[model samples]
Target: MFDFIRNHKRLMLILLALLIVPGLGLVGVQGFRGFFDNGANVAEVSGSKITRQEYDALLKEQLERMREMFGGAVNTAAVDTPVLRQILLDSLIQQRILADEAKRQRLSASDEAVRKTILEIPALGALRKSDGSIDTEKYHDLLAKQGMTPEQFDARVRRSLAIAQIGDSIEASALAPKSSAAQLAQLSMQQREMRELVLHPLDYSAEVKPTEEQLKQYYDTHQKEFETPETATISYAILSAEILAASITPSEEELKKAYQDNLATYQTAKQVRASHILIATPKADTVASAKAKAEALLAQLRKQPGQFAEMARNESQDPGSAARGGDLGYFAAGMMVKPFEEAAFKLKPNEISGLVQSDFGYHIIKVTEIKPAQTRPLSEVKQTLLSDLKKQQATQRFAAAADQFSNLVYEQTNSLTPAAEKFNLVVQTATVARQAMPAPTAVPALANPQFLAAVFESETLKGKHNTAAIEVGDNTLIAAHVTAHKPASVLPFETVKQGVQQKVTLLQAAELTRKAGEEKLASLQQSKSTAGFSPVIKLSRAGARGLTPAAVSAIFKADAEQLPQYVSAILDGGVYAIYRVESLSPLPELEPQRLTALQQQLAQLTGQLELNAYLASLRARSKVKIYATENAAASE
Candidate 1:
């Protein structure tokens, strides 16, 4: 269930409704005074509260997971506030439904079950010892590293397990009849063999010549299709982030001071090298036994320190570092589990520590080396400081220019030339049609509603300056001018004649093909062969590619090999009449693995079908209210 939730995160989030604020009126009634307060209340499902802070954390984690899944190709910024809100809201709703159902059914995860599931989680199992015990110190350190207390982590794990158990119960009971599987398999295995010959309409083009009067009549009837669409030409002022960034400059002194103030950020921390042996416990309840085994291994390590690498290579449960004699290469102070980090950092070179305990099991660490922290010189990051300073200055400059540009176009009612002259800005023109599209520069201002509204305004189109400067990004703004305009008009007929003719021809062809196919099927059925078919119909042997599965099944199920027969089937492009089934062969018996896989697939499909049907039933019964207009206004 957790895997399913992770895989279909977006869908799960939507179904949960953990984030979205439904309506401003509802929000106000719920005691939300402003946008921030409303947004902070992620969702209230029944009486359960999903706060904004919790939703944001989950959203961030999900984004990080997605980034990892896509190998970082996805733009993090593209996952905007609305999208995140929807995701959280969906997740919340799903959880609410599940929780309610679970409570009603008295279905809950047992303490033992929760513990077992937690023990299986790989993240918590990474700190074990060679003798299979939970490394207490390492466990504490791991919790500290994650900024979570042990109790808090355990509670979260328990909640997750309980939810998973509920989901499992729901899915486990879903079933499909054996007859349904057999029917599906039969349909899937069905095939058809047929022959076809296409007659192109263009072949009769020479016979389609019409009188001038007929052509004129056709043109008169379909005049609208030939007319041109309304078009517009607009002059615009571009204030882009790159342009602003290029214009602003920062002094040398500023860069040095900025670098000095953030000294820790420009310094590299000391790293320690260590190695360990691990033994894992499959269940948290077996920690006592695991600890005993860890103690035995610890004694062996104490007796022979030189045998550490050999023992780690042979016994460590960590596949990642076990192959390399359990060598955890150089890691900084905060990188390792807290207990391990503390022990490793405290040790001198070549010093070996006693058995270390963590969440996974027990471990014995040896510090191979330690490097001192070093500060980076100002010269190394001077360019980065300058760039940051420039962006700040550019943002301010762009804001000032944007205000002036807006007033000039809206208030003064003058041309763009005045604003351009004042700001040393160039006037640009767009070849855009009435339909909205991103500008060549991908400036957000050009695509904004204000700009779009202004472009269509009568005042802006009539050579009057009725426009405004819009912010595109942090340091980008746009001031637009309406240069040309054309009123909406209907299309003319001549341009649409060919298209209509093609449509009519295709319809005629389909009808003709169906009629021919039906006749062929009848004749063949009467004679048991293609003995009296016209147009020199040929018989070709081929499997079904486009025919409906039901039709294909009827053909294949018929005793065609014993007696030649005719079967008609509707295909995507045309109809088909298969006159004979030349042969029949039983497929090979399914392999054990293939059979198992098929069963699993069938089970999953059956479960999904049941789940979908249940959700559909819920949707039918529930009163779902959508405030789309309100939500849209809020977004704008």
Candidate 2:
């Protein structure tokens, strides 16, 4: 057989090639076939697919952000919920859609724009040099920690900016009609003088009586409220950075190095609050003419310095600060143009500057307040540096032991004791449930959904074995051994009868209160009387006069065209109230500042609506399909 095979080797090779060619053709290419069958693609938008790897990466990034925002109080497990997963998946699809649209429309971000955006990120502030340029070495090192090259990060940011331009263009084109805004502002600012006659539930409680039949019915209907959740008595061990940090101590040299590396963060920049009168060289005026006008204003301000605000309001070309008496507010050294900043910083407090020329024109500046630069001494920041260094070392140590901790919990499945001893962790006991604990900072390891889900696994629960080690947070792993399990059950009706009776009494009292309040409203409507009403109080959206939102809404919705209009609302604690609408006082005219603010708010709302409609159109025209995964699926 060996001799025959050796002689027929070329023939066998030819036959194998013939068998594989058709399979490749049937699948349209083995590479693409493998990609589709990888079982990770979550959605297809336009012509591109969103893979599960992409979904999980984004989910992890969002989780890290939320963890940072709430510290350890944020539930890492809660972020994995189906609703959040769907939202994230939809976000990914929408981003893909927008990116595709941007590409189709040939929209792009310039290198300068991308650089400006990168420099503006607050996280990268430490990497900026004193000259306001990025430190190339530090920037590269920061990107290296995130496993990205500078080019890759730039490309990502450029793509994001291009997609953002689409929405920016749409928003800029949106215009809220002046009349509509005025009408809406009138409704928002309109105040009503109203008085209330409240029907207290406590007052009506004596008239209502609960019976045994009602208590039994209420208990049966709301049985879940009386039931105890399924809980497990478990012994768990935590391997956290804080635990590891306890054994580690940084030397003085390390602390000094860390402090030196982040020296910029320990210092504050000098700032000055100054007012300026700008005679802008608009198209109508030449630079010479604007400078002459500014010189005249400076001449006037020199004699009557206190009247500088009046001169700025009457003559300053800059509209933004003209209303505020040319007060440019407090700004740091780098905030203003080169010429203006130099002149402002050179002046002492209450000192005025001569004609300083810039692109805007010539400016007369007055320095009102100055805040000096401040730097913290090394000794004052030593403890913070020490704490940070300890955590850095501990995080490295935790990474080294995480796999070992995982292996120990799995290999010795019957108990968490082995893992606890190996990692020098304390095996603490607690009663945990399927849902998270109510207290924000109580038992985060047990509150972790992944850990809790593992604890509830049939094998782990039935065999009384340890759950697999789960990463609940950054540098935190947890494993648990179920000591005992109690299934969920409802308490007996007889035991909860008294509580049920209290609830029934409130329901009955609320009914009585509502009826009495409604009858009083009808009587007031016919009699047109303000008898038994409290003193009239002013009401608007901004000032609710201590009324519940529902009550306020009911009062505002009533017909105030006729005086003494009547309305009723049910307040909290089963208190009901009847309101008598006395008079409507429409704002005759919104103040200039408030009018401008209202217009801006209305424009923003209009822009958002237009953006939503634009996104909807894009979705309609594009072909988007979502694939179901084991986790969750976003709706099409």
Candidate 3:
């Protein structure tokens, strides 16, 4: 593959320009301008426009990455929605805006800085040589596949560094006031000395029973609460790939043929395990100067091959492998760049190559051990091959069978009986509601949502015919017919009358409880008596195990303008508690650790405020246009 690239260098360069020019020089590259100008653009920042083509490619990359990261756990429906589309567009616009600003400010990263940043990045680090320096040629190929050029990648990296500088300056300028910190610490540490009078709702339940007239009135006014939704009883027939696959058997001749047809996959390529010490020369040093330095070191290595590891340890320029004496673990042929791979694979075990020139610079490589090519026998992989063959046969049959399945259901119209009989599938029945409630992050299922929709479609709900085959999951389809349709209706008043009466009585009791508590608290404040008050003790904001946080907050919010302040609130489990704050305490100094934590929290808040302010200014100054027409095109 690479030989074509070397032989037709000009043709490869043209292909790279066609694929990568739009991204690197979007506005200025005339050859690609007509494509973006005539077509729609999703968003534009400053002078740089993110065309529809760019947005779609980025979103596709993000989706594929998500699928790889999540495997079977990925929810394609959720991830493919308009919200994710908008988010990706916004991120691209933001990067362009920052890049524009970096150019305006004359901020730049040297070639050495760009190379260092690339090596530090985890994704790019995978292409590093044995001595730790990045493989320049592999990096270029990766960028080409990503629809970007090396210059574009460098620009993006420079913009990122500039943005980080802005964030750092904002965070450094943020300082939390010491007095404000002290105040927060005091509030967080404050404690309260209080007592409560609890009133249970059940205590008033018996004295406030409702009349027959009231029960009837409530049932009439609140009919929606007692109504039943429309429902349907339907029968469905389904065909599954797994069930079909189990019924078919592959003969030994078939599995053997499959193995022979795809023989390359059954073989493993030759692997070479070699270590190297690289002399650094990534566009910084002249080729002649670098060659002279590399050949001088080559002379020493040839004199003493046994001292290769010691010489590599003291002199190698690759940071990643230098510490380990340039030990690169086992690798395959295509894993490394073409030039490096060719030189490494040519030499016998322990044979050192003379100075070799490549993109990164000249290098003297020592060949280590090589494992010969290998191929597995049919006996070893027979089981796996058999399973694959069965699945392939099952899939073809399922496709041909599916068209007939859909046709039978639609043609029969009245029932699922004909389709079920033809495929020998069981006709399953279910009673489901009209609502197709969403299961946002789950695999679409047979009964939960689409089934609800199938039974509720206008014609089916009216008992006209069965639903056409609906694909609810991979290699699975269902066709449902509504046998019985029931419209929504209100329940009989007689059935729910007793329950309604019980609810009315409880509501009346709660009102009575509130009024009684208010009257008793007023009398207590005036009389200054502990008549029936519960025992009082001091407690912090974090109340006892039984008391809730809401109850604690309510206690602190009580009227504290005078002595013996009173406040009441309904607590959980249908009880009302009236609190009396007998006295107030002055603020006290907090522990050293508590004070430190409080200060750190305040500092974080201040930093967030600064960051938001900075971003707001950025958005206000930048000319960001999101074209509605382009976004609509994307939606379609």
Q: What is the C-alpha RMSD of each candidate to the true structure, in Å?
A: 8.6, 15.6, 10.9
Off by over 4 Å in 2: 1-38, 63-84, 115-134, 248-393, 625-635
Per-model lDDT: 0.60, 0.78, 0.70
Candidate 1 lDDT over 409-458, as tens digits, reads 66656677887777777888874455444333344345544456657777
- Choose 2 or 3, whichever is better by TM-score: 2
Better of 1 and 2 by lDDT: 2
TM-score per prediction, in order, is 0.62, 0.70, 0.61
Superposition error at 350 for model 2 (Å) = 29
Show where candidate 3 strays beyond 4 Å.
Answer: 1-130, 133-175, 238-412, 417-425, 436-451, 473-476, 524-549, 559-564, 580-636
Please, what are the lDDT tens digits per residue for candidate 3 over residues 1-636?
A: 855654443334323323222343222212112222355676667657777766655644554557678884544334444455566666776666655665787776577765566565667768877556677898999999766788877766655655555555665677887778888776666777788788888898878978899888888998998898888877877776765788789998888889999899999999887777788677764777888888888898888988777777888776776777766767887776667789999989998888777667776777678988899999999989888988899888997888898899889999888988887788877666676335442223344344466668898777578887775544567888888889999999899888888877787788888778778778877887766678886766754546777777777776666767777778764677877778667768577787776676687668769877876678779888776432333221
Query: How far is 259's C-alpha from truth in model 2 (Å)?
Result: 12
lDDT per residue as tens, model 2, 258-360:
8889999899899999998888876645987887878888888889999988988999888989899989999997678889999999999988899998877
Rank by lDDT (best first): 2, 3, 1
Worst 10 residues of 1 by lDDT: 23-32
Question: 1 or 3, which is superior by lDDT?
Answer: 3
